[model samples]
Target: MQSTLSGRGFRPGDVHTLIVPLFHVTGLNTIMPTAFHQGATLVVTAQQSPRDILALIERHCATTFFAVPTTMILLAQTPGVEQHDVSSLRLIAYSGAPMPLRAIQRLRELFPGVRLHNFFGLTETTSVTTVLPDEQALVRPESVGLPPPGIELKIVDDHGDPLPANAIGELLVKGPSVVKSYHNRPEASAEVIVDGWLHTGDTASLDEEGYLFLQGRKKERVIVAGENVYPVEVENVLTRHPAVAEVAVIGRPHAILGEVVKALSCCDPTPTLTSGR
Candidate 1:
C-alpha cells in the first residue's frame, strides 16, 4: 500500500477526484469539495463507467480516488484499467456497504501500491464514523474498522449497557461529525439520538482490538431455530461457489427447524454444484 503522504509530503493544494453518484452523501462530502478545500479540480460526470473514471484520473492527474464496493468491482473487471496512468492515485477511499472479500482481494492484486480506505457510516452520522485502514484490510477484511478521528463508537446491548468484546449489539456513535437532528422529524431524531449518541440500528461487534465488524441491520436479522442469522453471512458463503455470481439468503418456514436458510443465487448459464442437493 502507498503511504498516506505523497513523496513530496502532504500538499494542501493537492487535487483529488471522485466519480460518484450525486444523490449520495459521499459525493456531497468528498467529491464536490475537491475544488473548494484543496484548490483541486472537480470533474462532474453523469455516467459512472470505469473507463470514464480511469480516463479522468489520467487526463487530470487525479491523486485521490473514491467509490463504493460495486464501482470497485467494475474497476477490477474493466479492461485496460492497468493500461491507464492511474499511478497518480495515492488514496482510494470506498464505502457505501460491506465489500465482498473477493473484490477486496482483487483490488489489492490490481493496485498493489495504492491506499484503499473504507469509510463506514450513515447519513445521520454525517457520512462517516469509521475508516477501515489499508493495513488491516487483508487480514481483517470483515472489520469496518475503528471509529474515525473525533467519532466515538460503542456497542450496547438491549439494556443500553455496553456489551463485552465480540458480542453483537446496536452500534451507537457520537461525534462532532454526527447530525444533530433530522429535518421536519423530531420524532425520528428522538428515537435515534439519545444523549448525543446516535443509535445506528446497524448491529456490529467490536473485537478486543476495537475493530468493528458489521452484522446485519436489526430489522434484517432472520430468526431461525430460535437463533438469529444474518442473511449476509449465508449470502457470502453461497457466493463463494464458482457458478454463483450473486446470492441472496432468506429464512423460510420449515416443518422442523421453524425456519431454514433458503439461498437464491444468480448462477452462470452453464453451472455445476459440488454440493449434493
Candidate 2:
C-alpha cells in the first residue's frame, strides 16, 4: 500500500473515494491501507452508481479515486458527467481487469488534467505489483508498467525456463508484499508459491524496457484442434470493431476440433451479427 501511494505520488491529507467492494483486495488491502497510511480522508460508497460517485467527488472534493475498469467505463458513459465538478481529482487508479483503449481515451477526454494509472495485482500479492504511471499512460497504454518499488517480475515458460523479452509466458512475481501462504489452503498455496516466486497464472509479455503487457489468464486458454487460442487476443481484435461495446471469448466443445473459440459480444445499436448465435 505504501509502495502504491508513493509510486503514484499520493500525498498526506488527500481525499480518497472508495467505491470498490471491501471484500476485494483493491479495497481491503490497497485503497484502504493506502488512505490510512497517507492520512487521507476516505469517502466510502456502498454502491457503484455513477451519480453517487460523481456527487461524492463533487461534494467532498475527492483527490484520489480507485475503481475497476468496469466502473470507470460506466462513469465515462453516464449522462451528465460534465455537470459534476471533478477538477479536484489528482489521481485516478484502475484495476481488476484490463482496461479498454477506448475507455482510457474517454477518461482522458473527460478529465483532462487528472493523472490516470493502470494498476495490476492479485489477492496473493496483497494488491499492486505494477502500475502504468500517468506519464506513460498514453505512451504505452497497453502495458501494466514496471514492477512497483520492491517487486520483481519475470516471464517463464511451462518448464520454468526464463523466456526472452516479448515472449508471452506465465508471469512470476517476487516481492516483500507477496503473501507467504494462503489461509488454511496449504495445498493451493504450495501450487502457486515456489521458492520465493509466486506464479501469477497470468500470461504476459515484457518489452525491452520491462513494461508488462497482459495476454490473458492461462486458465482461459482455448484449445482449438492442436492450437492454443488466447481469449484476450480475440477480444482485443473484436473490440476494435466500431459497433462492439464489450466482448468476452471462451472455448466451446467441438467433437472434431476438441474445442472451438467462441466470442460473445455486446453491440451498441443491436448489431446484425446477433442473429447467427
Candidate 3:
C-alpha cells in the first residue's frame, strides 16, 4: 500500500478522503494503510452520495481521493458538482471496475489540475499490481498501467504458455504481496494459485512497454459463432453513446450462432434500437 501511494506522488501531511465501504478490500487494504503509512490524514464516510463526497472534499481539504469508476461517474454527473470546492484534491484514483472513456474525459475536464490514476489488483494481491498514472491516463485511456517494482506479471494461454505482447491471455501475477492461499480453503485457493503465481482470472494483453490492458473476465467472454466477445469491449463502445448512463453486456443463447451479444443500458428516456450491420 505504501509503495502504491508513494509511487503516485503521495506525501506526508496530505489528506485522503475515502468513501468506499470498509468491508471491501480497497477500503481495508489500500486506502487506510496508504494514508497511515504516508502520515496523511484520513477522512472516511459511510455515505455513498456524490454530493456528500464532494462536500467532504471541500470541507476537509482532501488532497487524495480514491473510488470506483461508478462513484466517479456519479460525482462527475451529480447536480451542483461545480458548486463544491474541490481545489484541494491533487490525486484521484479509481479501480474495482472498468471506467468508460467518457467518464475519464469528464474527470479530466472537471479537475484539470488533479492527477488521475487507474489501479488494478485483487484482494489476494493485497491491493494494487498496476497503476495508470495521470501522464498516461489520457494517452492510453484503456490501459491499467505498468506493474510496480518487485512484481512479476505475465499473459499466458490456457496451456500455460507465455504469450507475447498484445496477445490476449489470462493475467498471471507473482510477488511478495500475493497471498499463498485462502485460510482453510486450500481447494478453492488451489484453483486460482498455481506455482506461486495467482491466476487473476482477468483476460488481458500487455503492450510493448509492459502496460496491461484488461479485455474482460474469462467467465464473461461470450462465444458467438466461435468468435469470442469480451463484454467490457462491447460495454466500452456502448457507453460512448450520450444517452447511456450505464451498461452491462452479456451473452444470450442463439440457435444458429450459439450465443449473441445482448446489451442492457440505463438511460434517461427509451433509446431507439438501430442496427448498423
TM-score of each prediction: 0.87, 0.92, 0.92
Candidate 1 Cα outliers beyond 4 Å, as residue runs: 1-11, 240-243, 268-272
- Model 1 residue 84 CA deviation in Å: 1.4
| Candidate 1 lDDT score relative to the true structure | 0.75
Encode model 2's per-residue lDDT on 213-272: one tens digit a residue.
998989888889898788887888888676789999999999999999998988878555
Best by lDDT: 2
Model 2 worst lDDT window (10 residues): 268-277
Candidate 3 structure lDDT: 0.87
| Model 3 superposed RMSD (Cα) | 2.1
Model 1 per-residue lDDT tens digits across residues 76-158 = 77766788887777777788876777777888887778877876868786566677788877788778777755678899987
lDDT of model 2, residue 30:
81
Q: For model 3, how does the per-residue alpha-carbon lDDT over 50-69 read when each residue is reduced to its tens digit?
A: 88888889999999898888
For all candidates in order, the CA lDDT equals: 0.75, 0.88, 0.87
Poorest 10 consecutive residues by lDDT, candidate 3 = 268-277
lDDT of candidate 3 at residue 128, scale 0 to 100: 81
Candidate 1 TM-score to native:
0.87
State residue 206's C-alpha deviation in candidate 1, in Å: 0.8
